[model samples]
Every structure is written in C-alpha cells, then in structure tokens.
Target: MNPSHSHPLRIGVFDSGFGGLTVLRALLRELPQAEFLYFGDTARLPYGAKSRETIARYAVSAAEFLVRQGAEYLVIACNTASALALDDLRAALDIPVLGVVETGANAAQAHSHSGDVLVIATAATVESHAYATACAERNLRAVEKACPLLVPLVEEGWIDHPVTREVLSIYFTELMHQSKAAALAPDTLLLGCTHYPLLREPIEQAIPAQIRVIDSAEVTAAQVAAAVHAPQAGTPAAPRFFATDSPAKFQRLGSRFLGQPIEHVELIDLEALEAL
Candidate 1:
C-alpha cells in the first residue's frame, strides 16, 4: 500500500556516509510534504569494506534508531548495506523498507531493450554481486565492476577535477572492454554507488554516447514517490539530520550532495540508542 497523502509522513533515510544525501536530495523533490529523518553512520562508514555480518549489525542498529524516531518507512540509501544487509533490516524493522539495489535493477529491466546492463560500484557491492543477481532474476544480463577509487575521489571533493575525469575514463574504458568480452550488448550503465551521481556529468562524458547512464538515486526517489503518491507541493521543513560522528564535517560536506545548505546536524550515539 502507498503512504497516504492525507497525513504528514515520517520517512527515514540511512547511509554509511554522505553519499546517501543524494538519495535524500531526490526524495525531497519527490515528496515535498513528508518530513524526513536522515541518519549517517559516519563513524562506521564505507560499510563497503566490512563483513556482511558486521554490516547487518550496523544497519539494523541505524534502522532501529530511525524507527524509534517514528519513521514509518525506511530507505537504505547505502549501496553496501543494500547489497549485504537489506534482508536483515527488513527482518528487524516493522516499517516498510526499500533499498537502492532493487530499484536500480528494476529500472534496468524496464529501460534496457537489450537486457544487458553494466554496474560500477564499490568493492563490497561488487563482491556481493547483488546487482547481477537482481538483474538475472529479471532475465537481464549484467556485468559488474569494482570502482573502488571513485568513492574516495568523491569524498575528497574532486568531482569534476581533471584527475577524476581521467580516472573515470580509465574505469569506463575497462568496463566497456569487460562488457564486450562477456559478449553482452549493454545499453544501460547503472551507477551502482550513490556517490557516482555527483559525478554524473563527468561519467556521461567518459562513457560512450549510446549507453544510457542510470542514476540509481533518481530512480529510487521516483519509485518511492510512485509508491507513496506524495503530494506535489508543500514547503518541506528542513530534514532532521543525525550523524554518528563529526556533525560539523557532515554539515560541511553534505550540502554538496543535498544540493542545499544544511543549516544544522545533530550528533546521535548509536550505542546509546541501542541501550534504550
């Protein structure tokens, strides 16, 4: 069932770090009337490098914290959590849950006539092969590549720097070669990491013109909007922001991803939440 438009909705967005802000930014556009609670597990970030068991524990703790804050729905905005711990979050939370990986795969199925897609994501996400599994379930062939360097580049605020562009060029060139080697005619290039959306312009320039770049963040927001039937216009209050560590850093870096000035961010202790 879709979220009712008649009453204000409380939506929770969780990410390993600032990258998930891109999804929140899109959600703001799609669901202007809904109040948002965004939690970034900055202290335990890059969930990408952790074990699945560990990722699940951290994700569940974060999700529970948001639910405690009255979240009616949860959006797992981190690709690593979505890849490794989505089922854990769903099992642990009573609220409806959506993950970027599924939305992205669904989009690939809908948009790709050739039924072939390319995914570039962090090492953990690629290791899990979630996108490949999801696409194959939809009868689509997928080639996944680990673009580990991109995340650090994004966090370093070098989005459009020439060095970043050259890195993209190298990554895409290798990815295209892999696609060809797999004998797949891929028409859809999925930005498997939320951080990649920030580099969209350069990514588009780096890849071949014929291949469509899918911003997973955009597709996830559209899917949520469609599911909820969110109202078209309402002056949404600024989202309540929570960070596990370094609220100052989050506030400083988050606006770039959110596309708006973050007036404030609150520091929350996850361990303290778990005690409650």
Candidate 2:
C-alpha cells in the first residue's frame, strides 16, 4: 500500500522481545518520518522453544493488536516468529506483512557470488530452516547454524566482550567446517537473528575477509523503505513503544538496540488475547 504523505505512516514492528528494536533502528534510518509502533511480546518471549501453533497464536495476537492501533504495515522482527509464523501473520492480517527471514535471504542472494551462504541464528530459527528454505527459493544454498548463547550474551550487553567474541569465533569456525564438509563455497554470512546485528563488529572480525556479512535488520528496513517509498524530509516524532511485560526493563535494555533513549514504553496486557 502506498502510504499517504499527508501524515506520518503508522508501521508496526513486532518482536518476541526488544531485540527486534534493531530492525526498528534500521527502519528509522530508511523512513525517518514514518511513525513506528514497536511491540515487544516479552511476556511470551523465547518463541524459539514453543510449538509452531503456539508461536503463531502469540504472533498473530500481537499483529492484530498493532493493526487495531492503526498499523498500515507489519514487520515481523523476531526471527523465531518470522521463521515459524510469518505465513500465519499474513493470513491473519489484511495489511502487508514482511518477515526478516525473507529479507535476509534476499540480501544474501544479492551479495553471494558463489551461490552459497551461511546463516547464524537462534536454535528455533535453525530448527525451522526458514533461512535455508528462503535462500533455496532464491537459488542460494544456505548452511544454518544455531548459536543459542549469542542471544543471551547480547541481551547482557556483551556485544564486544571477549567472551562474546570468542563465542562468535567458535560458531563461525563450526559453520565454516560445515560449509566445507558440504562442499559449498560460501561467500556471504547472513545474520539470521535480529540480535546478531549488535555483534556485527566482532562477527566481521570472526569471519574470513572475503565472506561478507548481511545484517538482516538493515536489509529488512531497506526493503520496507523501498516498499513504502522514500522517507520525507520532515521532523518525525519518536516511535511509540509497547511491551507485554516489564516496561521498565524494556525501556532500559531496549535503548541499547534502538540506539536512543526511549522516554517511555506503555505496558500492554495480552493475556486476554493469548487466552483466545
């Protein structure tokens, strides 16, 4: 849908947790004048461990809530939900829905000259095989690795910590070994999880020089910007923030991902919706 420039566009960005703020951060760069409604389903986070049905239910409820709040577009920023419930979200919502997995794959297809790509994401995303499938659809062979610890480390504000760097090194080493074993020459490394972008610096240091890293948040935002047309040169208001639980903590840690101080985050109760 072409958003009218008469007023700021209300774009909804949904994530299992605040990590998706990275996507919002990128979106702000692409469409500075657009109004973003960011919802963090923190109460039911780690959608990675839940069953596919459960994840879809949680994500659909979140999406519906944003739509009710006048969201013209929906961006599924959580990798787990993007991997497992993207189709469910599109089916449940009338507005346009974009998932990071597809965007990441699209970026990988654009960057990979060797037709092989490596994906690093949360365990649930790896289990879903969404990146691999998306990449395959784009005719790019993808090797997915589940780096579960990275999420916690990133949330702990250890983006450049020695331990985080070491962990990244190990994961990249294992991914390279897997790629070699599969007899595929990988030219691109896709950060399949939103949290991974926080560690991009160390991640680049961990990988080979020739292999480029694709930040899913950046690509997803770029694609969304392209879809919604260019950003207008106007003073955009601060984004509206909502969280299922822990408004205080969300405000605290969310700032790290958003790269700005979030003045306030309205606490939302999704229990009634979850019950349905």
Candidate 3:
C-alpha cells in the first residue's frame, strides 16, 4: 500500500559505525519524501571482528532502539550485522527489515560476467560467508577476502593517502594472485563493507580494470525506494541523527556522507542498552 503524501514514512537506519551514513545518503537521494532516523553505534564501532553472537546482540539492541523511536521500517546498513544478524532481527522486529548483503549479492551476480566474484569485507562478514552463501544460492562461484584494517583507514579519512594506496596493494595482491592462479579472474569485486565505497577509486586502481567493483549502497537504496510506502503529499519530516558518542564528529562526518550539513546530531547513551 502506498503511503499518503500527507505524511512522511519514518525509516530507521542503523550501523555499527559511521559507514551506515553512506547507505543513509543513498536512501535520502532515492526517497526524498521519507524521513530517516540514523543511529551510529560509534562506541561499539567495527563489528567486523566480533563474534557472531555478540554482533547479533548489538544489532538487535540497535534495531529495538530505532523501533522505540517510532521507526516504521528498519535498514541494517552494516554489512557485518547483515551477515550475522539479519534473520534474527527480521523475526524480532514487527516492521520489515532490509539488509545490504542480499541486495549487494544480487548486484554482484548481475554484473559478474566471468562467473567468478571476489568479496572484500571485514573479518566477521567474510567469516560469515554471507556473500558466498548468497552466490551459491544463485549458482555462482565466490572468493572472499577479509580486510580488517580497511575500516580504520577509511575512518581516518586516509582513502587518498599514499599509505592507503600501499595498504591496498598489499591487501589486494593476494586476491589478484589467487584469481590468476585459479585461471578465472573475477570480473567483479564486491565492496562488501559500506565504508569500502569511500575507497573505491584506490581499490579500483589497484585492481584490474576488467574487474568491476560493486557497492551495496546504490542497490540497497533502490530496494528501499521500492519497499517504502509512499509519503503523504505536503508532509515534511526532518531527519534525526544520533551517535553513541561524539555527536559533533558524527555531524561533521555525516555531512560529508549526506552531501549537506547535518545541523544537529544527538549523543545517545548506549549504556542504557545494558539495562534493556
């Protein structure tokens, strides 16, 4: 059912870190009529290396927080959470929950003409084999690599730094070598983490041009647009941004992601999660 134009739909987006802002940016671009509530768990950032059980717990808490804020639908913008916690989240939330993994996997499958795909993500996501599972389900072959340091590098805003380039070379050399050794170079490389999108240019330069890189933000945004109930006309809703810590930093970084200033970012007390 379409949402009436008189009222904007409230969509909640959550991430373990600032990376979720990338997904939120795309969502805003695709669905300008909707209002968004973004929560970045900066205190517990980088869920990539955490245990599956731990990631799931954190994800559920974040989802519950968003729901409590009157979110009608939720987006798990963190690939780590999507990989390890999506099913459990879906069962727990009354509203429809969307994740980046499946949407990204679909995009990779569609663009990968060579039948070989490479997935680069955090340790947790790579270990979860979320992309591999999705590819297998679609009758495709997959190779997964974990770049544990990439997130920190991106967070430091070093995507264009010389050290970043050097690190990319080191990280991607193995994948390139493996593809060559397998006699099936991957035609597509999936930037399985949201933060990886910011490193696209460097990553692209480090890899062969024949290999296309896919980021889930765009595809996920399109899916969100399709799934949202249309907003009521003339209804304007403002976005509420929240961070577990460093509200000012979040606002600054969020403005970079959103392509506009985030006038206000509230600091959330995630310690409350323990009580819950």
Which candidate ranks first by TM-score, i.e. highest? 2
Off-target runs (Cα >4 Å) in candidate 2 are 230-234, 274-276
lDDT (tens digit, per residue) of candidate 2 on 55-128 = 99999999999999999999999999999998899998999999999999989988889999999998999999
Candidate 1 is scored at a TM of 0.96
Estimate candidate 1's alpha-carbon lDDT, on a 0 to 1 scale: 0.91
Question: Alpha carbon lDDT of residue 133, candidate 3?
Answer: 98
Rank the models by TM-score, top first: 2, 1, 3
Q: Positional deviation of 30 in candidate 1, in angstroms?
A: 0.7
TM-score of each: 0.96, 0.96, 0.92
Q: How many residue pairs of model 2 clash at the backbone?
A: 0
Per-residue lDDT tens digits of candidate 1, residues 1-276? 454555568899999988899999999888888889999999888798899999999999999989988888899999999999999999998988999999999999999999999999999999999999999999999999999999889889898799999999899889989999999999999999989999999999988888999999999999988876554556666699999999999999999999999988989888777787
Greater-TM-score candidate between 1 and 2:
2
